[model samples]
Target chain A: MTNQKLYHAHIEACVEAMNACNLSYVANLKEYNLEKLCECIRITRECAEICSFTAQSLSQGSQFAGEIAELCAKVCEACIAECAKHNNQHSRECIEACRHCVEMCKDLMVAA
Target chain B: MTNQKLYHAHIEACVEAMNACNLSYVANLKEYNLEKLCECIRITRECAEICSFTAQSLSQGSQFAGEIAELCAKVCEACIAECAKHNNQHSRECIEACRHCVEMCKDLMVAA
Candidate 1:
């Protein structure tokens, strides 16, 4: 997740990035009519959801901010690796969002 | 988050729930060109994201499963209350998702 108020443009960027990964995952799976990459798709969805959740919790000042941020870092790393395989604007956007999330989560862990 | 492997239809249900909330939040706010509900929209995004992330982390057997589930409970509660104020199918779907997430989170906390 991200802080739009603080990071600026992160809101749109993150949403775009997430949507890109999700949309592509579902679309590709549907077109292929195979479940070969279902795990990856599922992970992408998870990555998207957690980032969104972490951002909100931080904004709301949730108590587990540190733990949440730590997990966010892990998920971000995974998602970044997955999204990087694609060569599209959405993948690019998702990579950026994941990168930003990784940085924020690391910072949060330290602050915690 | 949900467990499609265990919860059967949880995957579709959760995705539907989250998409409903995110779509409506962004669409309505954009159409109205009003920032009044921006906070709520942001929260909705957060709620959707966290559930997804939590589900994935649990599936992967993350170390902070218990704490993640606990935070999930709190966010789901807040989202339920906020989503309840809206009387629509999307809100209904979101409500179900929130309900499911709450139950799962509570159960996870207990098991932890």
Candidate 2:
């Protein structure tokens, strides 16, 4: 079984990213007519889903938790890149959350 | 932009998989102490998350919807394999949902 204590920070970051991405997704979805924000909405949804799954896997001590963390980090980076292109508060918060998640995933990978 | 009409069945299957996986996850979580069911619980959560994102992207006509569908199909397959090992109502439903999702994803991919 995996140890949750060791990856607590990583899990927290992933959860934070998930929440931020979900908020951003909903905000962007409302403005669906905006062509420029389509990619942002899509990537935010992707990031949220992956972060949610990664957080759940870590919390449950799944055998592939580390691999999921790696994938989550990659998606966070993509979310950050896309969200950065927009200047809204929601995008800013999402970028911050994704950045933190990436850092935490890096630490978790190193610790593993 | 991706056309939702072309992939309506795919989106429907993804939603079905998502709902079934969520149900299975909740059902198995109550029995989290059962080591044998842990994998099922974890995979169900994974499948649910990916299916959710894939459905949202397809509904929104995201440019990368096809790619997401591909990933969703792969996760559904994993869920099917893991859930198959367990013989329970939740697992059975998950397996059926994932199987349908995989078939729809395949059709969507070919059409794309």
Candidate 3:
């Protein structure tokens, strides 16, 4: 894929991850056993924020896009690891989105 | 001031900066002299995103809050520099907000 195509794909993946992580974070907060899911909630929220920022920076073609992508990938990986410990639907979705985001971020980095 | 107070203050400053940057970015996009304000628009958008993410991360007490704050300060500085070149009301507000954010970020880092 062209660099432009890779950029677009990466942005899409970041958005997807952002949405999923947000949803999972909210869901985790609403859980009765909040203590057990504290890390999950925190990581998911952090991942969502990073993913959203990365997508916005990429859309603007900002000079910091590469740095933002690197952070996004790292956050996504952390989110995936945390969410993978859970079996809920939201966590599953978050993990899947985060995994996709990590892959896209790597591809975008390579293309850069 | 306590660390918690500083964190809350930093988050507030980041939110203010984000709002100002977003407003300035949108206003710049509507300007007739689009070519001259292109850098202003781009930097404002990037600054807004970073400020937003930094605020969210700080609010969540995320482990990466420090890193996000660093990036937020950097982006806010860039926005301030770019907006200072423009003599519009929106740019003025953006510069003020970004300057405040940078100060708050510095304080938070020192407290850390």
The most accurate candidate by lDDT is 2
> RMSD in angstroms, all models?
12.7, 17.7, 9.5
iRMSD value for model 2: 17.9
Which residue pairs of candidate 2 clash?
none
Best by TM-score: 3
- In order, candidate lDDTs are 0.61, 0.82, 0.76
Off by over 4 Å in 2: B1-112
lDDT of 2 by residue, B59-82 (tens): 888888667878999999999999
lDDT of 3 by residue, B52-102 (tens): 777656655566666677788888988888998999898999899999999
* lDDT leaderboard ranking: 2, 3, 1
Better of 1 and 2 by lDDT: 2
DockQ (model 3, Cα): 0.07
Backbone clashes in model 1, listed as residue pairs:
A1-A51, A49-B49, B1-B51
TM-score of chain A of each: 0.70, 0.92, 0.90
Give the CAPRI class of candidate 1: incorrect
- What candidate 3 gets wrong by more than 4 Å, as runs, is A1-6, B1-112
Q: In model 1, what is the error at residue A110, expressed in angstroms?
A: 43
Give per-residue CA lDDT, model 1, range A76-112, as digits (tens).
7888887676566655666776787677677777867
TM-score, candidate 1, is 0.44
lDDT of 1 by residue, B7-65 (tens): 32333334334554565455445546345556667778887777666654554445677
lDDT of 3 by residue, A29-92 (tens): 7689988999998888788778877765665455566667788899898888888889989899
